[model samples]
Target: MADKVVPIKEQKLMDVKLGQLPSWLAARDYSAQGIFLGFKAGYDRFFNKYINVKNAGIGGFAMLMTGYVILSYTWSYSHLKTERIRKYH
Candidate 1:
């Protein structure tokens, strides 16, 4: 029986054209301007649409309570003084 040799396909690297990117990403002001716009949009949506006075008050109170508990525990640990015992001959 004769054996048949099959050729393997070679992978090729694709060239990225500038036009392939979105208009915002392809613009020269993409880095800082785009990031600031995105951050502003997110901040606006979060504070305006999602957050309110009641939610902010509750969140702040919870955070304050947590901080107080942590501070109390740390203060107690930091105030404990070590005692040494001495033996007399």
Candidate 2:
């Protein structure tokens, strides 16, 4: 009796989609539990969705390039201003 292992359910041909996610989210608005669930959803997006097997390489590369561009512009803003001043001088 103790050796039984339960397998996860596989997708079937006619799967039924459940409740409206938006309505459910709206129902939990501004409460502590809602905030916790929001954090969990954010973590799931960043960790699970972003780093998944199918598009992980492309998605990660795109994200890295975007971050690099934004940070590069931000970090070099002062230098760019100096160059602009030097050019106009």
Candidate 3:
């Protein structure tokens, strides 16, 4: 008699503990193509449509960081100039 091999069907559901959501979201699932595609599309749409705050959340953070860097550089240059003047006097 020949042995029969039972094949397992691939499932879309990802298994994990309750507190592992961020890790799970970072992980890639090659088995669930449909679910992953849907999730990506939904996430992109949500970010595009639901993000109504004009330059006040993620964009605001980016702008603030840039402004801070620029202002810091300007301040450093001014402080160095003052130091040079004091040294020359």
Candidate 4:
């Protein structure tokens, strides 16, 4: 008789530990963790693809600064528009 190898997906599903917790809670936690990790992995892939500069630290800092500038501009623009409308009223 020959042994067949089980797929990793089945192996992982079989390895869930339901210690001191209800079956539904354990499954829900496992599913939520999986989704969070999957989203982080996808975001990391996209960031690495676009932000591959010479220095990793500098690249990260640049991205942070860019995001800050964008948010600042949007905030100031919205505030100014609201102030203009208030003055007219």
Measured by TM-score, the strongest candidate is 2
TM-score, candidate number 2: 0.38
lDDT by residue (1-89, candidate 4, tens digit) is: 88676533433434544552345344443578788986797678757765665555666668768989999989799777877766542
TM-score rank order = 2, 4, 1, 3
TM-scores of the candidates are: 0.28, 0.38, 0.25, 0.31
Please report the TM-score between candidate 4 and the true structure.
0.31
Clashing residue pairs for model 2: none
lDDT of 1 by residue, 1-89 (tens): 88554222211113323454443244424579768986797667656643545555466457557879999877886454332243455
Runs in model 4 with CA error above 4 Å? 1-38, 46-57, 83-89
User: For all the candidates, what are their Cα RMSDs to the real structure?
Assistant: 17.5, 10.2, 13.2, 9.9
Pairs that collide, model 4: none
lDDT assessment of candidate 1: 0.53
In model 2, how large is the Cα lDDT of residue 68? 90
Report the lDDT of model 1 for residue 42. 62
lDDT (10s digit) by residue, model 3, range 24-60: 5555455688688978976676566546456536764
Candidate lDDT scores, in order, read: 0.53, 0.63, 0.61, 0.64
How well is each residue in 2-87 modelled by candidate 2, as lDDT tens digits? 95443223222133235444444444548898689878977677767667656566776588689899999999999888887665
